[model samples]
Target chain A: MIFKIAWRNIWRSKLRSFTVMGSVIIGVWSLSFMLAFFAGFIEAYVSSAIENDLSHIQLHHPDFKKDKEVQYRLKDIEAIEKQVTSLDAVKAYTVRSLNNGMLATATGSRGVQIRGVLPEKEAAITNLDQKITTGVYFDATQKRNPILVSKRLAEKLNLSLKSKVVLTFQQANGALTSAAFKIIGLYQTGNAIFENLNVYIRQEDLSRLMGETAMIHELALLLNKKDAIEATQHYLSQHNDSTQVLVENYQQISPDVNLYESQMSVATYIMIVIIMLALIFGIINTMLMAVLERTRELGMLMAVGMNRSKVFLMIILETILLGVIAAPIGLVLGFLTNAYFGSYGIDLSSYSEGMEKFGLSDVVYTHMQTADYLLIMIAVAITAILGALYPAFKAIRLKPVEAIRKI
Target chain B: MKEVIKVQAIKKTYNAESIPVHALRGVDLSIQQGEFTALVGPSGSGKTTLLNIIGGLDAATEGSVLIDQQNISQLTDSQLIDFRKEHIGFVFQAYNLIPVLTAKENVEFVMLLQGKSQAERDARVKDLLGAVGLSEQIDRRPNQLSGGQQQRVAVARALASKPKFVLADEPTANLDSKSTADLLDIMAKLNREENITFLFSTHDQRVIDRAQRIVTLEDGAIISDEQNAIGS
Candidate 1:
């Protein structure tokens, strides 16, 4: 009966009730959308980092991390490759010979990290062949040594496809060696910093120039399932000789990526708290007005033997009913909006330059965990209950004698 | 007849900390079971204040009120509410039925507060609404009913809980002569048939004329208390 009265009482002022519901609906919808947008933004940035630079896992000679010298190249490459290929979780793997060198063209010279990679293996792991905006990816038919420079790097060097560039670096014997390579292709990744610093070349050409046959410094592995990353890293870490080879996951390799990923949950919770706080105030204002306007009726109720607790409960029930009705509508609207945007994506092309500088993609597809949705629903329910307290307290505090006489 | 209400030397002063305005001055009154009584006076005569005190809606500045021999003045605010719920019924001048509720729901509300079973509430609502000649308007909300009909519903609601007595503050003040007469007739019939006690605070001669006992007040003091053989 209290429920019946409370339900009917909210409808007494239909406009006011709808106003409160509208605010709740809008708050929930915007909060959900904002959280998903942030998640998508972070997902785009982290995935770009992983896909273009850091694979799911990496293995390197332990000393290579301390110094990028050519002498720190991996020992027993065949044995390491055997262990990596045995894991079903590894979808693809590649080995690279890394060197810090200076690339010089007719116009200028700049520092660059020359990555010597097996063309097909590197292409399989990082999808490197697809990033080519011009020319071919490490063509075998080219007579001279072939190299891939980023489009940004090509512009900075004032060079284009088939242009001759000189790479100078230290050999395994600490001898200064210089090699001339023709740029076969120009690739563009979302990361401006990465594009500016790194260039790729064939492993055989690089190993031959470095005065060694198999000069593998780093082994990168891409996993089929993201959820399997930790377990795969654990298995590899347990199997490998840690003192010789350092095994690290993408997060362990890139601290900023890990930081961004962890902050996503914190940012999501902060968004929910901020939105729910606004809703609490909205609900408090509406319920307070409802209580104030019904002073005489509340007095009459108390005078007729309705207890203070029952009166308080009725006001709370009314507020909760408003949330209960509006939250699902908002959730559905949010879900549909996310579904549409998730599939089609929200194009941030207008801000692409700024986003790309931070390694983020222009088009972001919204994504949220099922747990986040449930958390938001619980947050709104708690907000409703919190919003009802002050108004309910005001209601229960009314002396029936004075309230009844209130004109 | 057994006494249903006993008010002994009850006094009420408003704004006591500043300029005190005494609304009730040591008034003593009692109503027997099955009696129809009126507390009558002009404005500021303290009739409503006296009725408020007797109804447990307000505390006395001095003295005590015993409803069915329970000293309500000694009861805490929360206890007073429970005591009122079990022992008292009120009908306000504005026909204070819950506007959101239908005629039947208005009468059934008090019974619900009492935690009466649905079958018990339904039976009593039907009986009481029928008694007040509102059987046909059972589904109509308060706004849909006329002033007379609304007051009749109020009367039915006041008796829904079967209180020891009913306190009405000008129940007929807003009604036409015909509605007033119809309301008085229903009250008189309930009093005679079911032995329900009624106390009213009013300035209306019609209500004063129908009371079996009239307690008139002036300047917060009872000036006259008399029983009229002419009224039943």
Candidate 2:
């Protein structure tokens, strides 16, 4: 009966009820979209890190990680690759010999990490072949040394496709070595930090030039299922000769990616709290007015035998019903907006230059977890209950004799 | 007959700090079961104050009000509300039917508070609304009804809970002559047929003339209490 009365009472002032409900609808919609937008940004950043340089997991000579010396190479690269590849969790793997080198053109020279990679394996792991913007990824027909340089690096060095550059570095015997390589491909990974430092070359050519027949400094692994990354990393760490090799996951390899990943949920909660706090004041104001306008009616209700608790419950129920009615409309609005933007993505090309500085794509696809949607609904419900308390208390505090005369 | 309402030297003072205005001054009154009585007085004579104290709507400053042998003054605020719900029904001068509810729903509201079953509430609402000559107006909200019709709905609501008595304060003050007569006839019939007690505070001569007993007040004190051999 109290529910029936309360339900009917809200309609007595239809415009006021609609106004409060409309605010709730707008609040929920904007909060959801905002959370989704931030989630997309974080997703783009983390995945770009994984795709560009940080594979799901990596292995290196324990000494090579501290000092990039060419002598600290994996002893039996073939055996380690064989063991890791047999595991079903290992989707693809690449072996790389890294050296700190300087790339000098007729214009200038800059320090870079010259990565020695097998073209086919590197393509599968980093998708480097697909990111080429100017030329083919490491042409097999060429007799000269072919290399891949990021578009940003190429532009900095004033080099283009088919341009010749000399890479100067130390050999395995600590002798100075220099090899001239042609830029076969110019690629852009949308990562300013990676673009500024790293360049790719064929492992065979680098090994021959450094006077070593077989050299491997790093092993990068991609997983079939990302959720199994921890299990695979644990397995690889235990299976390998722990005294020589160190296994590190993507997060360990790049701490910035880890920070971006963990902060997504925290950012969502902060957004919800901010939006709900604003909504709380609006709801409190609306409910307070509702209670004040019905002072006489509420007193008569109490005088006719409705207890204080019932009156309090009636007021709370009215506020909750407003949220209950508005939430679905907001959720649907948010869902439709996310759905449309999730598939096609929101174009941010006009700001691509700024976005690339943070390794974010120009087109961001909004993504939200199921748990976040549920959490938002629960948050709105709790917010509605909190907003009702002061107004409900004011309603139950009315003295019947005085309130009845309030006309 | 058992005494349904008893008051002994009940005193009510408002704003007792700077200047005390006594609304009820040592007033003693009693009414037995099944009595249709009127509390009549001129303006500022404390008839409404006495009615409020007896109805448990306001507390007396010095003395206690006992209803059906229970000392209402001794009850806590929550207990007093429950007591009023169980033992007293109110008909306000403004016909304060819950504006959101229809006439039928207004009458059923008290029974809902009592936690009565659906069948009992339905039966009593039909009987009371029919008895008040508002059977045709049951589906109409208070705002849709005339002032007299709204008061009739209030009357039906008052009796729906089958309380010990009905307390009406100027129930007919906003009514025309015909409406007042019609309302008086309904109260008289309900009292005669069902033995329901009624107590009203009024300045209307028509209401005073129809009461079986009349208690008149002067200067916050009851001056006369009389039983009439003839009443409308």
lDDT: which candidate is best? 1
lDDT of 2 by residue, A171-214 (tens): 99999899899998998999888898999999999999999877
Residue pair clashes in candidate 1: none
Docking class of 1: high
Give per-residue CA lDDT, model 1, range B117-147, as digits (tens). 9999999999999999999999999999999
Standalone chain B TM-score for every prediction: 0.98, 0.98
TM-score, cand. 2 = 0.97
- List the candidate 2 regions with Cα displacement exceeding 4 Å: none
lDDT of 1 by residue, A1-407 (tens): 89999999889999999999999899889988898889989998888998999999999988888888888877889998999889999999999999999999989999999999998999998999999999998767767688899998898778999899999998878898998998988999888989999999888988899898899999999999999999988887888788888999999899999999999989988889899999999999999999999999999999999999999999999999999999999988888889899999999999998988888889999987778789889999999999999999999999998898886
What DockQ does each prediction reach against the true complex? 0.88, 0.83
RMSD of each: 1.1, 1.5
Q: Quote the lDDT for A168 in model 2.
A: 98
Candidate 1 stretches greater than 4 Å from native: none
lDDT of 1 at A242: 89
Local accuracy by lDDT, each model: 0.92, 0.90
